[model samples]
Target: MELFVDLQIASENQADLPSLTLIEQWVCIAIDAGSSKTRKEAELTVRIVDSEESQQLNGDFRAKYKPTNVLSFPFQNPPGITLPLLGDLVICKQVVEKEAMEQNKSLNAHWAHMLIHGTLHLLGYDHIIEEDAVEMESLETKLVLQLGFPAPYNEQE
Candidate 1:
C-alpha cells in the first residue's frame, strides 16, 4: 500500500512536533493495521495548528469549547465515485505537548498515539459506544505497542 501525506504546519510552536517522515510512518502503521484489503494508493493531509484554531474548530464541529488534541475529518465520497482520498487530520501541537507532560508520556509516543487514533477514525473506527471503543482501543494499543510505545489508554500514575 502506498500512502501520500500533505503535511501542513500552521502552528508557530514546533517544540515537540514530529517530522513529516515520522508522521507518515505512524499514519501508515494505523492504515496497515486497520485496513482489511490492500490498496494501490492512499492520500490524506495532516495539519498542525495552534490552540486558537483548534478551539474554534472544536467548538464549531464538536460543540466543545476547549481545544482538542486532534480532530479527524473523514472524506465522504460521492455516489458512483471512488477516490484515494482518505481525509484530513488537524492536530493541536500545544494540546498534545500539554497532554504528554500531564500524562507523563513521551512526546513521540503521544504523537504516535494521536496520529494512530485519528487515522483509525478516518477508517470509520469510533468510540461513541462501549463495544466500539473497546475494539478501537484494542487496535490502537496493539499498533502503539508495535511501535514500542506504551499503551495509550493505560494512564500512568
Candidate 2:
C-alpha cells in the first residue's frame, strides 16, 4: 500500500474528476489485486488532459483519432536504476464524463473504473484476446466491486 501517484493536471477541463486520493486508492486496489507482489511499492504518473490532447496522443501512439477515457503507458526501466516506476496514465476528463453520462454510470464509479483499468494496463493486463479479455475484465470487475463500486461492464438496463 506504499504506492505514490504523481498527478498532473494538464487541462482545466473537469474540476479534477478523480481527486489524487481516489486515484491512488484505485491504483492501489488494482495493484494489490494482482498476483505479483513486486508492485507493492510502485510509482506511476497520472495526467488529466483535454480531449484534444487525448486525441493527439491516441492518434500518435495508437493511430486512433479520438479521445479515449484512459490510456496507459508502461515504463521500461533501464538496466541500472532500481526505481519502481510502473508507467503513466493519460485520462481525458471530457470523454470520461461523457461516457459516464451516456453509459448511465455514476461519475465517481466510472472514474474509479477507468483509473483501475489503466492501472491494470500498466500492470500488464490487456483484453487483446478472448482469454486475456476475460481474465482482465474479471479482475477489473472484482477490484472495482471490492472498492465499493458496481461492476463496470454490467449490461445497461
Candidate 3:
C-alpha cells in the first residue's frame, strides 16, 4: 500500500517527533489491518490541527464541546470498487501534547499512537463497545509495537 502523510504542526511548542516516514509506516500497518488485501492503493490525508479547530469540529460533528486528541472523518463513498479514498485524520497538536505529558509518555510515542488510532478509525474501526474496543486496541497495540513504540494501553493498567 502506498501511504501519503501530510503533517501540519500548528502549535509553536518545541517537541521533536518522528519523521513523516515513521508516521507513514504506522499508518500503513493500521490500514493493512483494517482493510482486505484486495482493497489496496488507497489515499488518505492526516492533518495536525490546533485545539481550537479540533474543538470546533468535535462540537459540530460529535456534538462535544471539548477538543479531542484525534478525530477521523471517513469518506462514505460507494462500496465495491477499486482505488478507495479512505478519508481524513485530524489530530489536535495541543491536546496530544498535553495528553502525552499527562500520561507520562514521550511525545513521539504518543503522536504515533494517536496517528495510528485515527487512521484505524478512518478504516472503519471504533472502540465504542467493549468488544470492539478490545479488538481495536489489540490491533493498535500490535501496529504500535511494529512502529517501535510501547503498547498504548499499557500505561492505563
**lDDT (10s digit) by residue, model 1, range 36-86:** 777788899999999999999999999999999999999999999999898
**CA lDDT of every candidate:** 0.93, 0.88, 0.81
Give candidate 1 misplaced runs (Cα > 4 Å). 155-157
Error of 1 at 2 (Å): 1.3
Which candidate comes out best when scored by TM-score?
Answer: 1
Better of 1 and 3 by lDDT: 1
Question: Compared with the true structure, what per-residue lDDT tens digits does model 2 show for residues 71-102?
Answer: 99999889887777889999999998998899
Better of 1 and 2 by TM-score: 1
TM-score of each: 0.96, 0.93, 0.87
Taking every candidate in turn, the Cα RMSD to the unseen true structure, in Å, is 1.4, 1.8, 2.2
Which stretches in model 3 have alpha-carbon errors above 4 Å? 8-17, 79-82, 155-157
**Window of ten residues with lowest summed lDDT in model 2:** 32-41
Alpha-carbon shift of residue 96 in model 1 (angstroms): 0.4
The candidate that wins on lDDT is: 1
